[model samples]
Target: MVTDQAGHPLFTTSRDRVHAEGLWHETFHCFVVNREQRIVLLQERATGKKDFPNCLDITAAGHLLAGETVADGVRELEEELGLVRTLDQLEHVGVFLEELTLPGFVDRERTQVFLTESNQAISDYHLQATEVKRLVAFSFDAFATLGDETTTEVVSIEGERFGRNRFVPHPPEYWAMVERSIGQSSM
Candidate 1:
């Protein structure tokens, strides 16, 4: 079942149908930052993804399957990045409504945003090859600038050079909200 603007259940529908019809559904977005709060993790989407293939995206995010609550969606972090974390370890940022219309898809998601701090090294992550390519960290400042298209800072991922174009095109406000959330949580 999908939800309305107030997050009330609207009706039952298949996931594919919901996307094709622009129905708002629930999703979970988690950002894993370093303990010192200097950087945030980004995951390169695997080339096989149907949408935004090979683009750098949130540390971990996924849709909530039918009947799944937001807390249950936390499993996506461990499933995609091998980072096991409990709900109590995550600080809820806020809910966001994201709307994007691609060539043949209309994605309207009500996202539950969360943040967690970790000092885990990239080498320790066991990536799910089909969903994530690799993980990289960007300084909070650099990421904010990139999101706003203020600078084309070169970022190295596994020895390969990448720039703003390689990252997903989230609105500047989204980046700002993320930064603010991180700041508030660690205070």
Candidate 2:
């Protein structure tokens, strides 16, 4: 679906065309956290993915298809990570407008983010091999620190030592919004 700057519906288009033309569309992002441990979940995109392959990203996320509501986005959890959750079980975070430009594709998204608490171990997840490579847990505090571009610290994720560059380069504002959401959810 394509939309105007304010995210009002304008027209519907193919997903490929939307990315190719940088058309704005709705997306859903779910961050599964273990609140008791103050750890957040990150999924490694499959290596064969066309964009940002193998990069650590939100626990589960996908674009919202035309005619689907934000609640339908929860299907991504089951499809990607084999975790079934209902909208009522998730805390709805604020929507954010985000844009990313890569060599062959552009992503302009009006994203609705959500958070859900889960105590499941990383190794217990049933990953969809084609979409997710691995699931790892990281300290929420350490993840927040990466928002600072000047930070030179490297932290280990899974078995890899990752600097900020190792993850997807989402805008700093997006990180700030997510940090604020997480902070509020814990209160």
Candidate 3:
């Protein structure tokens, strides 16, 4: 489904057309964090993915099809990460507008972002092979450091260090918003 700049429905079109034309569409992004441990979970996109393949991204995310309500987007969690959760089980952060342009593809999205708190081990996640390659853990403190301009790398819980290039590359403002939200989230 395509929509206006504000996410109000306008018309329906194929997914390829939506990205090809840079038509604004709705999407859901869920970040799962373990508040007590100050850790966050991120997923590695499968190498075969059309966009941003092999990059780390939100714990779970997907496009919201035509006629689906925002609440229904929670299904992405179960579909992508095998985590079943209800709308009430997550915190709706806010709707954000994201625009990314490549040589041949453009993506304009009204993304509904949510935060889910969980302490489940990485082994507990059953990843959808085609969408997610693997799950990784990062310390919230280290992630928050990314908000600083000079902070160049963050080490994952497993001891591997990575820079922003490892991520899907959201704008710095988006990362700032995520850092602020994580700081305010309660157990």
Better model by lDDT, 1 or 3? 3
lDDT of 1 by residue, 62-149 (tens): 9888788889989999999999998889999999888878777888889899998889888899899999998988777665665465
Pairs with backbone N, CA or C atoms under 3 Å apart (clashes), candidate 1:
none
Best by TM-score: 3
CA-lDDT, candidates in order: 0.83, 0.84, 0.89
- For residues 4-113, write the lDDT of model 2, one tens digit per residue: 76768888889989999999999999999887888888888999987789888889999888888889999999999989999999998888889999887999999999
Model 2 lDDT, residue 42, Cα: 85
TM-score of each: 0.90, 0.92, 0.95
Residue pairs whose backbone atoms clash in candidate 2:
none
Evaluated at residue 3, the lDDT of candidate 1 is 94
Residue 155 Cα positional deviation in candidate 2, in Å, after optimal superposition: 1.7
